[model samples]
Target: MAGLAVPTWDPQTALLIGAILFEAIVLYVGYGGLERLVGPRLMELLVGGDSGVGQ
Candidate 1:
């Protein structure tokens, strides 16, 4: 494992990691919005009741 160690803080690695983080955040927000929009119906269908969330 020690032999596999690589340099850190290089620009390309930073950019790649940053892009992945940004994409993750975007997906999270997008899915959250979609859930907010239709989650109640889906939950009702699956759980057979209101999701226990106060409307």
Candidate 2:
């Protein structure tokens, strides 16, 4: 028997959590950059050439 199997705050678990958080931040920044580059143009195309953002 492995005796009282209590959970421990392992380094691997901490690292995994950190990696997930880093990925989320990176994705957010990437999407925000993409939006800044193309969002207004995309909106204009969809709304027939009058972009509300520019005004």
Candidate 3:
């Protein structure tokens, strides 16, 4: 009778997971920057004048 086989590490799966993690980090930073750059302008346009919340 054969014993249970152990699972081997998969390089392709590891690389795929690494790439997904990298993309998520990049997207998080990129969106944060975009929000900082455009959030105030968007609020001004939607609210019509200075909200004065930041100041």
Per-residue C-alpha lDDT of model 2 across residues 5-43, encoded as one tens digit per residue = 977898999999999999999999999999999998888
Q: Give the TM-score of candidate 1.
A: 0.64
RMSD of each: 4.3, 4.2, 3.7
| Candidates by lDDT, descending order | 2, 3, 1
Error of 1 at 1 (Å): 24
Weakest ten-residue segment in model 3 by summed lDDT: 46-55
Give the C-alpha lDDT of model 2: 0.89
Worst 10 residues of 2 by lDDT: 46-55
Per-model TM-score on C-alpha atoms? 0.64, 0.75, 0.77
Error of 2 at 32 (Å): 0.4
> Residue-wise lDDT of candidate 3 within 5-46, one digit each (tens)?
887879999999999999999999999999999998888788
Q: What is candidate 3's TM-score against the reference? A: 0.77
The stretch of ten residues in a row with the least summed lDDT in candidate 1 is 46-55
Better of 2 and 3 by TM-score: 3
Angstrom error of the Cα, residue 47, model 2: value is 0.6
